[model samples]
Target: MQAVFATTQISERAAAFLPVERTDGFEERRYLDQRQSEYLRMLAELDELLLRNAVQWYQQQGRNADQWLSAVAAARQESRVQSGQGSATRRKSSDVFSRARKLMGERGFPEDQYPPKLVGFTPQQFGLERVARKGLERLKWELERYEPFALSVYSGATREFRTVNAPVRLPVDPLSPGEVEETCILTGGDPFAAGERVRPGVLSAVAGGAVVQLPETVSGRRLALARWIAGADNPLTARSIVNRVWGWHFGRSIAANPNNFGSTGGRPLHPELLDWLAAEFVDSGWSVKSLHRLIMSSRAYRRSSRPADAADVARLDPELRCLSCFPARRLTAEELRDAMLSVSGELNLQVGGIPNRPELHAEVALQPRQVMGSFAAAWVPNPLPAQRHRRSLYALRLRGLPDPGLEVFNLPTPDFSCERRDSSTVTPQVFVQFNSQNSWSRSLAMASRVLRETATEDGAIQQCFRLAFGRSASATELRQCLQHWRDLEAVQREAVFRTPVPPPEVVRDAVEENTGERFQFTEKLYGMDHFVPDLRAEDCDARTRALADVCLVLLNSNEFIYVH
Candidate 1:
């Protein structure tokens, strides 16, 4: 845990970006600070690539959980001691500094005027930091007992550390509600009483036909409650999951309101089928994959979305309750984002990894927001294309903030469990889908991919249709698209575009939470010196960009976004 967010491991490629020494004094410290900035900028990349799989890898190597934390710490120490690199550099620098001092003394220079950096630089001691949770809440009361105590952090400007040599204390039982209410609360040596605390206890809830009480275990109450929920006697759990699965496969749920199965919820169209699936779910040990396979293999699921007689089917089922054919529904927010990435050949298939901060709208990415009393830190995306292209399943979800691209498509609020999301067609959805940077960039990538794999411009256009819509274009459609591409190329011929676009390093200003004074901090953009970017407008010629424009049109079409 100590090294989980450690900012000391500099990328190997970063060394090339390190500045060359001019004829100047006090340069060593500046070099050190630059290194500090590099690590900070590489935060997203390192977090995803390293430290993430340490515990899992250790377990796979047959090590215990207790040893993994130690392994992480040892790894950091080993990195610092590579061939005694840190110590060897210090020794070499000292030799150079002494020779300079002697030569200067021979020239009748004052020792007081000697450069401070000539003595050799001392790197800051990156001590153990207690990175608190969002609310600074301890995960468990017992965790405090085993948690590492914080070591001092060196403040470079002031050269002070009040936190150094701090006292440590283990967990103590919190006062009872009655005791807190009866006793006077004191703050800053004065009385500061609070309202009466609500007494804590579990309330009985109605589970189906029975009134169930929460388990009263000394510990593992969560485990006990989970077991009771999935127990043989409880049918609600299986029924609820089965209903949700059916809703995903079809456009609507077996019970229309998947969130609530009570009297207030909508009535089920096929109660017998729902019951059978629920029974199968519990019998198969609650396996979701098994449920998906069973549902997909059915004739109803395999039915064509286009019916032979649509009017007759609509007359028979006005609300689509009969499931006459497969329901043609727009993709969910996640699916829409993933599909675009997949079609562009940019989707990273590596599963179960770090949450990614995807490229967002410029206005949203640069928008200022407060955290507690100070402004929040800027959100930095991972530098590498592979890292940036992770699926939206692993996208970071901030409670109050959201990705604007995903939001226009009806992404649910992160704080709530939304069983249903309305896919309303708003004006912003049209703009984001067609004109947004995300869409344009993806289309550019798709065009580049097709251009590389196919020979002729015709083949590239055909390939775009296949990749985006899963089929070849018809004769008339092909002819129209060909004309469209040529016209676009004519316009693009005169257009000038920038190339080798470098990612930015942000310098953010914020008011200090404690001091209420504004200050600025540099946020390094990792891999800026050696970043390999995706294909852009300037990377391709007029002809290629025109094909890219056609690819963009295909991506914006309904056929690409709907599961018809």
Candidate 2:
């Protein structure tokens, strides 16, 4: 029976012993004998050198714990002294140590259980030693009890403060007649009555005669207003968005006036399509890209600009509102300039940084305007051509001085949102495209590109057509272009060779607003000092010059300016 028990002794039952549970005398004696025998066997199996090394390691751990505790205590004392809280801080520190020691003693780790070498250690170190000796259960219990207070103390110690100037508050008294006039001038508002003051509320007409309550605070009122405008129940927001996008693609919205959608505005020609699109836009979680894809991929959008049947042009779509075909529209000013630069290989497509300064006409660039007391600095293009050739989207937008080329092409003033661009066929546009120095330079560059990419005159003409319009020229167009190129070459051969004159020095004249006295200042042309001028007629051969004239004609063609 003893042999049978010995085999089963070290099995699962041996791992389930409870030290506090009392056992029968015979069982208890057997357990003690078994444990002693097992320990002896384990010691015999272990290497003597390994056993000695383990003992040395445990001794070194105790020494390390002692040193770490000593360092922590010294650091605490030094912090207290440096912070100028001498004796009071010392007394509080002592109280902390005393409380910690008492807590350790109560938690089954009495002072006598600790090593003799750790007797003089700080309470912080003593607590750590107790946790290490008693294991994770005791450490967890200690942390749960004290961690909140420790966190609060740490937060209080690291709190920061800064000095800030107080804001000036306006008086709450009613405005005087003079003050009301001044307020109207400053805010661009109608003159209020003697006791009138602005307050937050919905318009009475929109509120439907119901009592509407609003928050007293300004920010709360703004948030409430924003919620009202962006709420899911608002159909106008979604409908207006769809109409604007439609207008952008077709040059006219389903509703004629994109900004005005009320009873006063022109009624939508296709009300069902507009309502369905708005509903779908809202149902798709207000996704703009999904809405765009839905509209752009439709059959109506893909239809050819030309009518399928000439008879249907008058009967089926008299007003061109039946979606019979796509509408051909002139490119906007920004699009026109960007396209020209792109075809000439002068476009810089780098995205998103500070706005660039494209080379403006010298007259506009050097014009002086009164600012404060003195005249403002001259407008200079960015030094590098890469910057000067950036897309029109990156061009610096000045409200006072718009780009001359863009202005001539009917670019709206920047004072308000342009719901739709006007595409008027003006004579100035022709001059800007054909006569401007910038246009001449771009033409030269385009001609150079054609020469570099093509082997023969016929190939160059075809290449020019492909670059300008997205397709090759027809047989008649090809023949006419070659003839024009030959004629220009003969004319350029006999042209007088004159030295290219530089732009004249600019003298800025501004009248002082305060004194009404005129002042003249020489505007510095810093960008011109390192300017890399584009290819010109003088720099190229007669053939190249003639090719530029052909390119200039292509650039000014109706096909290049309009998008079908």
| Candidate 1 residue spans exceeding 4 A from truth | 1-215, 499-532
Measured over all alpha carbons after superposition, the RMSD of each candidate to the real structure, in angstroms, is: 16.9, 28.3
lDDT of 2 at 156: 9
| lDDT of each residue in 1-564, candidate 1, tens digit only | 111112111111111212442222122233333433343333323233334443445455564545334434554454446525643112111122234334445657555433332122111110001111111121122122222333222101112234422132211222211121222223454546443422212222435546554433223344446667678767677888889989888878898999998569998889899989998887888899999999999988988888889898889876667778888889988899899899889999876534666776656765666543233434545556777788888787776569888888898987888888787989998898898878888988888889889998678778988999889999888999999999999999999986535446666555444334555555444434444566678878888888889988998888988888
After the best TM-score superposition of candidate 1, give how far the Cα of residue 131 lies from its true spot, in angstroms: 17
Compose the digit string of candidate 2's lDDT tens values, residues 478-512: 99989988999999998875644334346755453
Best by TM-score: 1
lDDT score of residue 485 within candidate 2: 88
- lDDT, candidates in the order shown: 0.61, 0.63
TM-scores, in order shown? 0.63, 0.62
